[model samples]
Target: MSLTLYALGVAVLLSASFFYLFGYRSWRRRRVMAKPFPADWQTILDRDVWVYRHLPEPLQARLRPLIQVFLDEKRFYGCAGLTVTDTMRVTIAAEACLLILNLPLSFYDDLRAILVYPSAYRVPDIHREGEVLSESSGVHLGDSWQRGKVILSWEDVVAGAGHHQHGHNVAIHEFTHQLDQADGSADGAPMLRSSNALRTWSQVFSKAFDNLQKTLEQGHSELIDPYGATNPAEFFAVVTETFFERPRALHREHPALYRQLQQFFDLDPLSWTRAGD
Candidate 1:
């Protein structure tokens, strides 16, 4: 054989070895993560997360693996002198995974880290003045970035988890933003299963948003929080919070909008309501 041919064969062997090792390591890591769900974590979810308790037992079983994989894939950091705990991790993961419980799990794959603050934290707001940008800071309960980071106030997370029917869950709200960002733009639209689905969603959401705006202007009480009327992206996130947190109210007040969310999420939270009763 020619020297060049021998060298080529050796290179192919090395490449195969490298790939095999990498794949093996990944399989081993996932095997470890697949271990039975921890009892302490179950205790945390039971004690802290009201929504989890409302879920049917089979759905709870399905959600457990999603939570485990979520905890395995994402990293958490404590900011503002807060010490992160297992309870915090499990609580956050459970709430966040609740959004994608019925959808494919790939939606959150781009998300890499979650930064938790002890309370509402200040983030600088940048205003572009043509030639320069001005900065001012304001306190925020939570924020999601397109670059794979989510910031949350630990206090608000705890409150939101406990108060399941208040139409306010920071974890669910921010994670929905992550879902919106999955398609490379936070434009209140995630990648739907089909173009037809997108059209239906667009028509329903646009009409709902307009009606919501009109209702807010008329100073009438709305089932969805007024904060959702801010923008399409915020509207999606805000309504997502209400969908999971207060499903019955959403279904009753905005049946069309609630159906759109149900189709997109592929889960009927209203059934959970009936189950709870």
Candidate 2:
């Protein structure tokens, strides 16, 4: 064989060896990202996700990479004859990825599967009444489980994205719960797990929670969703919805709370909004 041919053969062997040493998943991730993003996916994003279109160029660049990795790694299943399509997956994945766009974390490391429902799905509603437990069922648009699962309703997901100013995204709400669960518990604060800026976060969130409860008791609830008063965990999730969907409103109504979320996510969503909106 010619010397050039022998060198080429040796290079191929070395490349294969490197790929094996690094891990197949990482190798495949590089390969997956090397390709151009599908134009059809961009069209779906434009139509389905209002936030995606408004994101600043830099953040937009950061997001596509995360979306690609999320779609590649996370598993999705259809429930109730949902027939989860690329549009659904892309819409949900885009919203979820937005939360983690600039933050440091695995792409939803603990999340292994997403169960998509055609609409609101029924779940067992267990309530405790001061030493009494009542068993009932309720319908939810989406939920995140600490044990590697997330469930979402396709219709609600679209609705949530459609009403971007409402700050009521099912995908964003449930995914925020997953972020809260990162510290091994859902106490409405994920800063204990992923952020060093804890003092301000604790001070602001605690005060805000107290203020919300007091205000609600006084029969005045605006500026934020009253459902956030449920608990710290739900509060965390709910505020996240507001933070992304209604950033300007949240910033105007509760600047301190918005700063805390901004600190944690390491991204200022206000930049994604319009000049005056």
Report, for every candidate in turn, its global Cα lDDT versus the true structure.
Answer: 0.90, 0.85
* Candidate 1: regions farther than 4 A off: 1-33, 129-132, 274-277
* Candidate 2 structure quality by residue, lDDT tens digits, 1-277: 6999999999999998887755776777778777778898888888878888888878777778777888998999999887889998899889889899877545477888999999998999999999999999998888889898999999999998765887688999999888888768889878443345676687888899989899999999677789889998888898989998889988999999998888788888897787656
Deviation in angstroms for 196 in model 2?
Answer: 5.5
What is the C-alpha local distance difference test score of candidate 2? 0.85
TM-score of each: 0.89, 0.87
The TM-score that candidate 2 achieves is: 0.87
Model 2 misplaced regions, further than 4 Å: 1-25, 192-196
Clashing pairs in 2: none
Query: Can you list the residue pairs that collide in candidate 1?
Result: none
lDDT of 1 by residue, 1-277 (tens): 6999999999999988987766654675578557999999999989998889989998898788889988888999999888999989999999999988888777887899999999999989988989998999999999999999999999999999986887899999999999999999999999999999999999999899899999999999898889989999999999999998888888888899899999998899898786442
Candidate 2 deviation (Cα RMSD) = 6.9
> Model 1: how far is 189 from its true place, Å?
0.6
